[model samples]
Every structure is written in C-alpha cells, then in structure tokens.
Target: MLLYTESKEARRDVVRKEHDIIMLIGDSLHDFAAEFKNKESTEYQRGLVAKEAAHFGNDWIVMPNASYGSWSKSELKMWNEKAEK
Candidate 1:
C-alpha cells in the first residue's frame, strides 16, 4: 500500500498516517475534506454536518473563528448573496 505522504493530496493525506485521528478539532469544516475547502455552497456543507451531527461533541470539535478562516469566508459569501437579492 502507498503511504499517504506518497499520495497526490499529500498535505491532507499525510496527516492520516501521522496521527490517530479519532476526533477532528478545527476552525473550519474544510479541515475535514477538499470538498469543504473548495467553497461549495453553505447548504451543501451544512447537509454534511447534519449527516454527521451525532459526532459533533465527540468525534468533531468545530471552533468557528470570526477573525478569519473558512467560516469567515463562507459568511462573507452568504452576506454577498443576500445583498445581491
């Protein structure tokens, strides 16, 4: 089997082998996947969160930062869309 460090998405993939990732703690959902990082619609990301809702407090710990990060970017996108309406 190929080591994650040898994979194409090395930065993200390498961490999988480096740690025992039982829980994810981050300021952005994007920390979990490329789809989340790629700026998909908020509804889509929320749906994924809903699907994994049971894991929030346990397997996932999201600390949204207002100062900066994907949370801020997504919020800005939402604000811009609302303004355009």
Candidate 2:
C-alpha cells in the first residue's frame, strides 16, 4: 500500500491505518534525499523517517536510489571514471 502525505504527522497518521509494512520510497523521502549534493543538507532524511516510524511503533523501510539518489555523488564519480576509461 502507498500513502502520500506532506507533513510528518500526516505520514504517521497513514501508518496507523494497519498495514503489514510501510515503505517510504522516493527521491525526496527526506530533505537530503533531494539536496544531498548541496552539502548543506546532506544528512539522511531516512533517519528522520526512521525516528518517526519508531515513535509511531510502525514498521517501515526506506529504500534509497543509487543512480540518481542522495548517495549518487560517489556512484556518479565512479560512472564518470568508467566513461573516461
């Protein structure tokens, strides 16, 4: 199941709907998920979600994007190196 909410409270509310598991998947799951390259907001947003999930006693998973994701800077550099080779 998928539930989209704009605020943290809303996200928690959705989790209360009684689902087997909740998975938050997206590019901007957190501020850093989208702004990781900015250096100013590189902290993982998944951590925030994880904390919230714990507080709500909800089962959740945060799936990260590798190609163009928050952690893509290193992967991008590797890909660029291969392209150069």
Best by TM-score: 1
| Local lDDT at 43 for model 2 | 38
List model 2 lDDT by residue over 1-85, tens digit each. Answer: 3345465545545666775334444444442223223344333544555546562323334455555755554323443666777
| Per-residue lDDT of candidate 1, residues 30-70 (tens digit) | 65555565566778888888887787889778887778765
Per-candidate Cα lDDT values, in order, are: 0.67, 0.45
Model 2, 41: alpha-carbon shift in Å? 1.4
Error of 1 at 83 (Å): 23
Query: Which residue pairs in candidate 1 have backbone atoms (N, alpha carbon, C) closer than 3 angstroms, thus clashing?
Result: none
- Model 2: lowest-lDDT 10 consecutive positions: 31-40
Can you give the lDDT of residue 64 in candidate 2? 50
lDDT of 2 at 45: 44
Those runs of model 2 whose alpha carbons end farther than 4 Å from true positions after fitting are 1-28, 31-40, 44-50, 53-58, 74-85
lDDT of 2 at 82: 69
Each candidate structure's TM-score, on Cα atoms with residue i matched to residue i, is: 0.57, 0.28
